[model samples]
Target: MKRIAILGSSGGNLYNLGGKEPLKLLGEIETQASSAGIKIAAIQFIGAKASMDNANESTLSRLYTWNSSEENIVFSEEKALKEVNGEAKKVDSIIAKMIEDGKVQGLVLMSSDPEGVNNLSIKAAAKKDIPIVGTGGTSMATIQSMGGKVIATSGTTGTTNRTRAVAAIQSLSRHWGLKYKPVISSSGKSSQNLDENIFQRISFRGIMMAAIPGFIAMSIVLALSKIPGLAKLNDAFDLLIKGLPVVVAAIAANQVSGLDEVGIVAGVVAGMLSIDGGLIGGLIGGILAGILAFYLIQLALRWNFPGTTANIVAGGLSGLISGLIVFFLISPIALSLGNGIRYIIELALNYNSIVAGAIAGLLIWPAIIGGVYHAAILPIVLLEMEKTGASFLGAIDMTGLVMVSAGITLANIIYPKQKSESAIAVPGFLINIAFGTFVEASYPFMFSDRLIFIGAILSAALSGVFVGIFNVKGTAYVPSVTAPALSNNALGFTISMIIALVSSFLITLFANKISRNKRNKEA
Candidate 1:
């Protein structure tokens, strides 16, 4: 079992601007690793306080051996100051220990911090030949840009990150055997200190760049897939649309491995699966193909068959074997899984849709927040949409979200202090709540105050009930509230939206009072 390492956060304000904290980031990474059956060996991080104390200490930083419990991790500036007078080498020391330990196969530097403890990782890679794979940290970014051959990916979503961890495992495992892969990095705000560099931010813009291809694919596919006039080209567009996830995932895996050749071969395998099973299957197949390709290459490398021609022969043969594996084994499984999930969706719809709506409404927040929703759940909804020309889950998901959000925003406007503090709330409440189904706009209120979130659950769930009761259905599969408006029973959807809004408003009034009372008492 190859164990992966989780390095802690970036030191300063860049940390604040970046998405999740290092602790949370590590936990997510661990989850991703676990889901794939990969074992994580260690998680270590230097706390922000250590840098503030103008000293680093072994005691102040935290490390977990095999388990990540609260008891195992510790961070304190005072602890550093108390234990060490000046800068301490605990991070470096731990890196050294990880290298010395035979079981700790690789490191995933999770820090967004550009400086501090990661310097040790870089030095260890350069001199002692340590195997480190970074996902989001600035340290890895910096080295990769400087012409260092580091194996890393800037994975923003959980599914993508899971693929990234697979890449890390493969690269690290290969590295331990030969230590030949060069130290690579990407430039981003994932550093220990607050440093504003234009290039770093620009390099992290790959996600934005990747989105262009997806949007183009979606636009062409959407225009081509649904229209009977374009039926002649429907298969071609469906191929492009469904195959996009495999292509995207393959590209990301290649970037992380720096093995474009293998990624290309794996992508072919994944694309074939997409033709059979659609997006979800393609994604799963893409991952398997990518990992298996690398695994094949690693096996080839171990053979060391004595010539420059060996790589070509080995890689070609490996690609053939990998393709066969994907075709014979993965494709059948993927098709079966797709059928099973569709049946599960049917069962969910059959099990009292109001309850389903309530469940979907409640679960959507966490799923979106955690990002697993996009990878797994949303695709299920999308598949249902494609098949039925509508999705009960999608309606349950979006209508409730929009109306309940509108209610919450209206409630916020009624509050003097809350409205005054956030100036933007004064002008754009209606347009944002009604129009924007990104749905995260409502999150600020929830994160700022959970009472609001609790209130929101009630309204959203009620909205779900109304949507189910009305048997609201959509013809055009769209993203949010507009989806229902463009549906077969537009009035039913609209009425349900209004019902949710009213319910949210009335319930939130009481919830707001309870919240304020709790806050006042706490104060």
Candidate 2:
């Protein structure tokens, strides 16, 4: 067994956008390691990502003691800063202990822009000459400037950086002749494949930074479309929401897939062609345009005349050629598909509010578990938010998450005997729900505690009805605590949250009481 520690800030001062994305990174690594017959000795996190606000005494004590745990309970941002002079002693001690105990062999630092000082372990690892892997250009630059001995440094794909980290460590392990079972590898996914290796993962992120203006344009409209009595402007806003993602994605894709420079003009062309396609059309058009432009640029580069302006000329020509071909050819099909998808979703939502919420709650888990839910509905939610200023379906799904968390918290209060489990799942899940808008914490309980699962779904449906009744609105494809609180419908969101928590608590308590009675009867 060998291990590497992943450390980072709270993702560029926010919770999920930067380092915290690819929420599935750890699980993917674990599965790969398990199949390869390698054991991950420990995966500890440090810094702001591990912090909790106004944490209870028990969690605080663990932070104070710096006791290690598999979960995030043992670390705290405040504790790290206030108690340790902005040093990463907890991180250092944890890794040092693991290495001393022959548990882990290396460290991989998930990077942040501007770099975070939460892990002073770079100097410590360098002193011991341990291999450290780092991500993010800014962080990697700092590591190099400081002469740290990290074996590798590169940009990470926002979605799949975890795999990169594990692969890097495995590369390090091979140098040491570490014995581990062989895992089947995917074809064309090795470090040498340009598309999978360098382009999508590293280049896409770098290029996307240039699309910030386009992003803000799309973002503000999603929020503004929620304003009341703006029906006349709905069509125009719809076009913006539908068009902008493509505009940004196209330019980004061109850089990632081809020419090595973002093409803003080409993106605008793709956007204009996909006027009413919303999120889905934008994604499809952008990706298509990128691929087309890439090949076109490749053709242009064959001329081989060297000049500083060559890239720009080649890129612009490719954009025009690709944009014209893609939009004219695919626009019709994209529009139909977009409308078809929207119609199906609207049909489901048009059902009774309670029924709609219940349907969404019941279906959400399966969709999430299968992983198709994100691809299928993110566009609809975003488009709906853009057109009507709300997504009842999205809200319904989110209400269930918070409700389940609150229920578990409430159950712990009523049933002290369950304190151990409660301590593990309560705020941990709630924090994710708030920050990442993730709702996976209680999913494991489906097999272990059927009653909890059922109660959570139904109770969350009730809260979803609350969302429907009040017409609660969210600003984006994902639902977060911040979205509603910052929305024009703040009061509705507040009430919906309260209803969700109380409803979930009561239902869970009732379910538990029934289970107890059934056990007593069986006895």
Model 2 local distance difference test score = 0.50
**Candidate 1: tens digits of C-alpha lDDT, residues 474-513:** 4212333455444446678777777777776666666667
- Tens-digit lDDT track of model 2 for 116-197: 3434455555555667664555676776666666665545432233234334444455555664321223321222233343
Error of 1 at 345 (Å): 2.0
Estimated TM-score for each candidate:
0.49, 0.51
lDDT of each: 0.50, 0.50
- How far residue 522's Cα lies from its native spot in candidate 2, in Å, is 14
Query: Lowest summed lDDT over 10 consecutive residues: which window, candidate 2?
Result: 57-66
Candidate 2: list runs displaced more than 4 Å: 1-192, 195-243, 247-269, 272-277, 297-310, 347-351, 409-418, 426-433, 470-482, 485-494, 509-523
